[model samples]
Target: MDFILLSILKTAIAAPVLLGTLAYLVWIERKVLAHVQLRIGPSRVGPHGLLQPIADAIKLLTKEDFIPSYVNKFYYWLAPWLALMFAVTAISVIPVGPVVEVFGIKTNMGQADISIGLLLILGLTGMGVYGIALAGWSSNNKYSLLGGLRSSAQMIAYELPMAMAIASPLLIVNTLNLREIVNAQAGYTFGIVPNWNVLGGGLQIFSFIIYLICAFAETNRIPFDLPEAENELVSGYNTEYSSMKFAAFFMAEYCNIITACSVATTLFLGGWHPIIPNELGGQFLPTLICMFFAGVLFYHALNPSRPSDRLSMGVIGAVILGLGLMFQVPVVKDLAQPLFWFASKAGFLIFFFIWVRGTVPRFRYDQLMRFAWLFLFPAALLNLLVTAFIVAVKSN
Candidate 1:
């Protein structure tokens, strides 16, 4: 009874926060991509396009829900929801921070903390592509069908290397539980270098690199985004989708990106652990970072990138500065610090995704498959073998 209630409470808090983040993530991506291209993006929608996500949500909700007479009604209706559900569900088992209590209730940061959390995430993410496949098949259009086919093939081709890359880290951490995996990554070498999988702990750098490359393909990000190459497929499987249906797939893609980033942070980057030791004032890092950003926002506010940004930027800066101040509170700092570190690492990974999209060109379909099968798969497999051997020798 308590478990059910706690789970429900966690979901209540997390769901809205996550949904809000997803909305702004799109805004962030656009603004970032715009800056990369020397353009001002989303400024007209709201103060610096802060309201753009809200505008988009309203548009999607108010638009006519289009359905084609030629399409298969049942499956077409089911596809987008399925994709969104599976994508969102995968995040539930991820451990964002250590356990904490509020109002006499104690619980972990995420929805579920099971022993098989990693497998649960893997299973949910794998099943998500079925929605894409079904959408294509049900559309009764060659383009949509081709998109679906490409996605299914992409998932299958890349999953092998991804799984193998993931396994190399597991051999070092030796647990399927996500929380336990994060805990195992704690501590530093010589009181400086973190014992993260990508570094001193296990030196799974090759594995980390492989996992990231495969993640791009898994999420259909640029340089590997052949599944819905609009030029070739006329917007691909989503061509016939409109209104909320289209929005569902759109949200699913972003959610998947976030999920992938979270997983990487947890498994490779020492989830929730600061780069430096607490004795060295690791606890104060969050406050410092927030204050730093607050300063930047205030500077921008005063200088006024555009006159419209002065008030908005100043308001945002003040709020950020207040947040930095709050972290100094003893009680709030305990909870906020771990969450901050987790968010920072995950946020950087997410930004990397946006960066790659702006800089890299899309790969040809055959080249994508060939790279996954011929190069990534073999490299991942070899890394796993090498990691197992090292762990075995060290154990002996």
Candidate 2:
């Protein structure tokens, strides 16, 4: 009963937060891309356009939920939800922090702690292809059908390299459990360099790079986004989708980006572990970062450009400052420090995803397939073989 209740409680917290993050991720992407093109993104929706996501959500929800007569209505209705469900479900096994006691209840920050967490993620992501394929085929449009086929083929081709890259780290860690993989990367060498998989464990830097490239391909992000190339496919599989269905597909894509980054963080970047050892005051870094942001907010508020910023920025800044101060308290620090580190690392990776979208051009379909098979797959396999050989020699 207790376990069930705790699980429910965690789900209640995680679900809403995940949805909100997905919405804001869109805003982040727009703002980033706009800046890259020398434009001010969304400034009118709210102070600094912080409320733009809420406005977008309302718009999507109220828009016409139109279904074409020629389309297979059932699968058209089912596909987006299916994509969103699997994308969000994969996060259950990703640990945000170490096990901690909250109000005398011992629990991990993540939802599930399954032994085969890595495999679970792989399976869920593999299943996600069905959603795109079904959406395309059911639409009864040539463009959508082609997009779906491309997506399916792309995922299949990339999974081999991604799996091999993922396996290289597992070879060094010797565990399928996500948390154990993270734990193995904890601590540092000579009290300076982190023992993260990329840096220390099997020195799998090339593996990490390959994994990231494969991740970009798997999530259908640019440079590898042939499946949804607007120029060629006319918005691809979900071109016929509108309103909340479209939003659901959008949400699924961002959720997958988050999941990919989180998995990478856990496998190679040291999930929740400080960049430096805790004894070296790494725990205080979060508080310092928050304080810096608070100071910047207050500075902008003092010379407010917009009328709303004078009040909104001031209040937000004060709240952030207060949170930063609270981190100085022992109990708060113990609870929040891990979360701060994990979020920081994951957030940077998410930003990287957006950055690449703004900077890179989509690859031609043939080029994408060829790169995956000829280059990424071979590189990943070589990295895995080398990592395994090193582990074997060390064990002996």
Candidate 3:
């Protein structure tokens, strides 16, 4: 059947892309943090370290897959893969763009369009904790046990605020389906600003802020990254893990970050919607951006900072320029623009994650818990109540 084939096709395309993105996200984080500290990151492996991920992958694959004598081998072996599976699975229900016709067959951009998509994400993410907890416990290390317990507690504490913040938007839209949540945020107000949940319809800016804060905690990202605190926990739950298994755990964390950003983009920022209406030249924005980057690349190519740059940079610049020109084609524009907007919004949020890591200090354990329960939980709860009241009044 066409449906089954399409599903297979989507999975094939999305899975590799997601995996590659997870790998590069690590490179991006390092480069960003390095620059923030006035240092160059990985650059020797390949051009500007573009091949760094590949090199790292090879290293991880070839390294010793060590197991501690004291640990439970079965559960220790299972944890990283389990974490990765759930992280990647959450992407299934997230629509990256509107429905489009390709090769005369209509298909949704995402893999699945389940009705209870939000609930599925929540359930899977909640289950991801089992991987971390099991990893720590099975390692039979006191430090790993402490780290695992901390992660479990942190997830439980922050999930309450995160769910409440998510609920505030659901109250406004009156839907549990992720696509419908995005569709409800389609139009603009005053023909200029988008009717996104954060801006127009829900005006749930506080909710958005609360969601982001909780997201940081939920993903165990810095200022709240106590689980893997190197100095405190000696690399935390995966301390006993090595080689490819360790890489799997690292990949899962970035994958979760990507999922969090994607969810936020879909729920609050309008998933694939342009910032302004298409009629207002919003469609041209991507072309303009690509061309601008192309121009910059060409300029650098001409300048030739490094000896190798004259050839490599010039070729890359030409390729970018060609892609920019391709966006002028009506068919290409139609197919690619939605993806562009979705990527832009999600990319910004991803950058924000890295930015926070570079600029913010890690929270002391007690401080992290206190902030989530005392401040974030109450704020999210109040926002949800107010949102419900407003929705009720408006419906009447």
Candidate 4:
């Protein structure tokens, strides 16, 4: 494909895919959280709450766009849009898969193939803080301002650890390009263990762990979500916003979660590489898993606990079975395998975030800040130092 056309094609595909994912991600979280809490969630909106996001879109779009009389007009309006833009923008450089020829046109899976992908993403993530800070301050509400301040502090504290942890892998890969970082981790140790940053060959699990801890904070997720704690600040930094502006902040948070998970997949989880090598029949794993899940769904459909689920589960199962069979096609199999592995890994990380949210309680503002500076930062620094030492020794 022509470079410009491919770029446009990628953007066109990515934007809608992301928006759609953001919608369903909310449904996924709600359903998972409901199961965790021993409750049924959103059952009234479409089959199994599948259309809940559409309802949510309509509601948010129709809600009153009220601007507070006491607010700073321009910054208050800009904050959420700014938050959303930066959150979603970071994905352009992420390598979803290696370069491949699709339909006789060659291209990389990512929208961009920039040399400094890692650096650029890090910078973009750092800049996302401005939105929160501005939203709180511009609201002219005391609690909102405090919430913003806490977020700023939390981010600053965790960022050092995250950057240091990221550096450990950088030293091992010897490149700043995200694609190169992933490529460096291709293949395995003794044809058994995959060379992911968190696994045997790379052995940067400590750094990966540190990075995850910081990731939770950077994305303002559970246990580190002091800035948005309802009990503490009553909607936190975005308290004054209404309608789509509020929804923008809401969507931005999820976008950041997805972006953070994607980065984790790229940096430490081998991007789109299979957890098991193809020689061991890893290529067939996705199809098998998909079929297995479909079977489970079919089983549930036969003995469904909910009346609605009887039909919904069967329909869902049939769709998944169809997808599983499609993965067996020769050409689709090649391209599909890589995308499947990438989605599975990234999907697991995203699930982990939701799982944590349903189970973990928010941290005290003071405790959150202290934990980041006192523990995560020092641990990351040590991990980076040890990684550098090992890589240097191996070179010698």
Candidate 5:
């Protein structure tokens, strides 16, 4: 009973934070784009548009609800909430930081510390696709149908490399729990470099690249954002949705983006771990650096073509945060090292995602289908084979 109550309490707390973070992500996207396009975004709302997300929330809430006459009412009503539910559920398995003892009870940042964290995330993501597809089918419109089909196909295709990328870390740690993975990389070597998987056999770097690329596609971000291609599909699957219904869909999309980043941060980059000063500083360094890096990486990944301003802000923020960590005592200083490396590596991958988004053009339906089938599928297979061989050799 106590554990169940605690789980419920955690879920309640996480719900609001997840919703607010999604809104803030949208605001940051706009701000990053403004910098990319050489214009200021959301200046009128608070300092540098800090309150812009709140304003948008209010506007979305008050908007009149619209329901198309021909639409399947029940399915239409169920789709958005389904999407949000699956997206949020994926977060339960993500371990954001180390456990802290509070009031004789230990609390971890994640909702749960399940061993099959990777599989659970993948499962929820697959479920999210169904909600998107159902929304289109229920709408009974050509555009919505087309968007739904496109998203369904795209997600299936990307799931290949994404799964393979996640497998690399599992290969190294030989466990499914995210907390175990972090613990594995807690220490430093040569009194300097951290012992993260990112620095391990060439597999780590390759896995990181694959995971980050697939993440963009999985989240349906720009470049791979064909489902919601405002120019092509007019608003995509949720085209006919309005009021809270549309807001639910919008929130779902942003939540998926954050979930994607968080999962990637945990798998390849190391979640909530600082880059420098491991165990040297306590939560101070890890929190500041991790947040700054996360913000920068997300912005860069979302807007790679023009991220100079956003990148600059991120670096400055990271430095300031790193300084805070440096001030902590040596006992906990080493603890912050994973966070520092985590930020640096995660930021690089996020920037890489942005660069790919900017440099590469969208794939045609057939091309997208073929690339997934021919390239990513075979590559992932090869990665799995090679990983197995190396593990066998190391054991022998």
Candidate 6:
């Protein structure tokens, strides 16, 4: 009973946070796009558009909630919540940092800390694609149906590579638990460069690349976002939605992006590992430092300035620090620096997402399907096989 109650409480906390963050991510996406395109976005809202998400939420909430006359009302209503729920649920098992002591209980930051974290994530994400497919089919509209079909095919194809790319890290660490994986990568030689899986052998690097490409596809981001190709399919699967229902779909998209970023952060970058040199050590200091960097980088990505600024350099600094902290071997007591380090790495990835969004154009549905099926799928499979072979050899 206690365990069940605790789990429910954690979910309650996480759901709202994830939902709220998704709302802000929408704001962040628009803000970053505006800066990229040389325009001020949502400045009319509170304080340089800080309150824009809130305002938008108000508008969405108050708008007329409608179901198309011909649509299956139950499925249409059920689909958005289903998507949002699955997207949010995946984040629970992902550990944000070391076990945080809340009150008397020493609980981890995330909901679950299972050994096969990757498998859990994969299964949950796979199930989420159905929501889009159902929404389209139930809409009773041709465009929505087409959009749903596209989404199903795209997700299925991309998932192969994504899983393959994910396998490489498992080879190096030999474990599926996210926290253990992060712990394996902790520590440094000379107070610089964290020992992340990215530093592994050639096969690992290849796997990382495959993972990244697959990530963009999995999240339906640029160069792979065929599900809702705004220009061609006329808003795709969500063509029929309006008001808060539309907002649910919008929130789900950004939530998936955030989840993908979190997953990549865990696999390649070293989940929540702070970069401060623990050998040169402080206690909780490193963790705090890492957290700070993580938070800042996260903010910066959401709200970036022009490209010419030295933000990239700062991001690199944070990544290094985070790696140093998470990789600490002897277990650095003062973890204040890591807070900054962890955040920095996360921020860097977020920056990359923004950069990709701005620079790369969306893919056509056919091209997107071909890339996933022909290229990414094979690459991911090859990478996975190689990783497994190397791991077997090393063990022998």
Model 5 per-residue lDDT at 188 = 55
TM-score: model 3 vs. ground truth: 0.97
Encode model 2's per-residue lDDT on 128-233: one tens digit a residue. 9888999999999999999899999999999999999999889889899998999999889989899999886558889889989999988989988877889999
Candidate 5 residues 179-238, lDDT tens each? 887777655565455556776322476777667667777877776787877788998898
Q: Write the per-residue lDDT of candidate 4 for residues 1-396, one digit (tens) a residue.
A: 577988999999989998999999999999998998999888888887789999999999999999999999999999999999998889888989889888998888888999999899899989999999999999999989988998898888888999999999889889999899899889989898999888965788898888888899999999888888888799899999889999999999999998899999988999899988889988888889999999999999999998877999999999998888887898887777788889999999999998999999888877887788888888888888888889989999
> Lowest summed lDDT over 10 consecutive residues: which window, candidate 4?
200-209
User: Each candidate's lDDT (Cα)?
Assistant: 0.92, 0.91, 0.90, 0.90, 0.73, 0.75
True-vs-predicted CA distance for residue 332, candidate 3, Å: 3.0
For model 4 the local lDDT of residue 356 reads 95
Candidate 1 residue-wise lDDT, 1-396, digit = tens: 388887888899999999999999999999999999999889878788899999999999999999999999999999999999999999999989998886666778888899999888888889989988999899999999999999999999998999999999999999999999999999999998999888878999999999899899999889877768988999788889999999999999999999999999999999999999999988888889889999999999889867877999899999998998887898887788888999999999999999999999999999998898899998999999999999999999
Q: Can you give the lDDT of residue 132 in candidate 2?
A: 92
- What are the per-residue Cα lDDT tens digits for candidate 6 across 113-231? 89888799899888889889988889988888988998888788878788878877887887889888888877654556667777632226777777778778777778777777878
At residue 36, what lDDT does model 5 achieve? 64
lDDT of 2 at 271: 95
Can you write out model 3's per-residue Cα lDDT over 1-396, one digit (the tens) per residue? 388988998899988998888889889999998998899999898788889999999999999999999999999999999999999899899999888888788888898998999999999988898889889999999889988999999999999999999999998888888889899999999999899999987798999999999999889899888998999999889889999999988988998999899999999998999997989988888888888988888888889889888777878888877877776787777667888899889999999999999999999999998898889999998999999899999999
**Candidate 6 residue runs with Cα over 4 Å from true position:** 102-104, 189-191, 200-203, 281-341
- Angstrom error of the Cα, residue 66, model 1: value is 0.7
Query: Model 3 segments beyond 4 Å from truth?
Result: none
TM-score of every candidate: 0.98, 0.97, 0.97, 0.98, 0.82, 0.83
* Candidate 1, run of 10 with poorest lDDT: 101-110
lDDT of 2 at 1: 32
**How accurate locally is residue 229 in candidate 5, as Cα lDDT from 0 to 100?**
78
Per-prediction count of colliding residue pairs?
A: 0, 0, 0, 0, 24, 45
